[model samples]
Target: MPDIALVLLAGAVAGTMNAIGGGGTFVALPALVAAGLPPVAANAASTVALAPGAVASAWVYRRELAPVGETSVSALTAISVTGGALGAVLLLVLPSASFGAAVPWLLAFATLVLAYGRRVSRALSTATGRSAEARMSSRAVLVAQFLLAVYGGYFGGAIGIMLLAVWSIGLGLDTAASNPMRIAQVSAVNLSATALFLVASDALRTPLVVATMLAGGVAGGIAGAHLARRLPARLLRGTILTIAVTMTVLYFLRGTRAG
Candidate 1:
């Protein structure tokens, strides 16, 4: 099969997984890289291609996302968009090999965060307990959101979980409400970064790959959104966690072998 076909297939899987919860890029990115794209380019390509999926999913859940009235959402979205653009620019400047080398560590970090997310979130909520500090300053949260966006745009693996923990625990929002807000914020990050990537030099050079992936992702995204409400939450979360850990270990082992 053509690499573009493979990318499209992977994007469909990614879109489906992302719509339900997580683990989409964990599947998509590696497949792209394995298909001969460098890590940074793969990251940019995947981000650009899969963004439409995020937007579609967000729209499908608009009732949840549109009504999130938290003061932090707008500021957080703004900073995340800025940070996403910066990340795309950084990818343009950085060496592909450097990005590839860094990916394992980044994935590992994301894995660690996911592994301990529930514990950490619970502890934070308990310790903070609706205190003043629990309601982190808008500026501080924006800065943190920016940092997360940088990582997210550069390589989005389990970024939603990280954002969820921050919004719910640090920002003291309830999980049920924070869910939609997280999706909206992530949608903004993906869209902004995708726009940046679309204009980047290399992105245009690989038009077919980007186009097909986008087409597949958008179609798959629609399917994913519909499936999200039907599947059991526990099963979806478990699948995401399983995929995340498997990808993390694979990357770690590859690094070890290379070293």
Candidate 2:
């Protein structure tokens, strides 16, 4: 029961971070591990607990979701769902020895992206703005989204930056508008992964932990949504990036020690 409370606290922090910048699982994932779950099970549990928070935050930003276009949204959502299913299968079937070894590198990549991703994204947007040849096709954008969604479902650290970078570079959208679409798209991936994990793993089906963490996520999402319209976002996002980087490094060290 105390462990579940700890999970809820982790979810609250994660939910707030996700609402501001994404990568909330960096916090909750380690907390799940500390709570006695294996890494794979922790991933599944984090997915389940955080799913509603994503849905809620996306809905709260529904106005931004509009700019994505209905056709593009449908296409991207379908691809994300497919990719997420595949990722879930990979989680369930892959041996922990290999996957565990891979986690640190994945975290490293995500950390790098989150830390300097906005500047790189801004540079690409600026370059695109200055040149006619910088434009990208819709097919390319969809493909990028599909691959990133697959990565998100497999391990959802720093996915927001990757998703937004694709949108900004491929579609020429502004940061604010791209953010909502990223949330919506990733929510689909999370849902698909959560469903698949539930089907594949009985270990993550913890009633008390799931209920508490998810409920806390819902509450935190609401708080984030309420604050989304407020200004000075870059500072908030920077703080989240710092925390995420630290958490990712710690988790990687833990994984290495466990190995």
Query: Candidate 1's residue-wise lDDT over 216-249, tens digit each?
Result: 8888877887776565656655654566677677
Off by over 4 Å in 2: 67-71, 107-133, 168-174, 236-240, 255-259
Best by lDDT: 2
Predicted structure 2, TM vs. truth: 0.82
Put down candidate 2 lDDT per residue, 178-241, tens digits, no spaces: 5667778878898999998777785455767777788888777767765755735575455545
Overall local distance difference test of candidate 2: 0.71
In order, candidate lDDTs are: 0.70, 0.71
Residue 236 of model 1 has an lDDT of 52
Q: Estimate each model's TM-score.
A: 0.81, 0.82
Worst 10 residues of 1 by lDDT: 64-73
Tell me the deviation in Å of residue 19 in model 2.
1.6
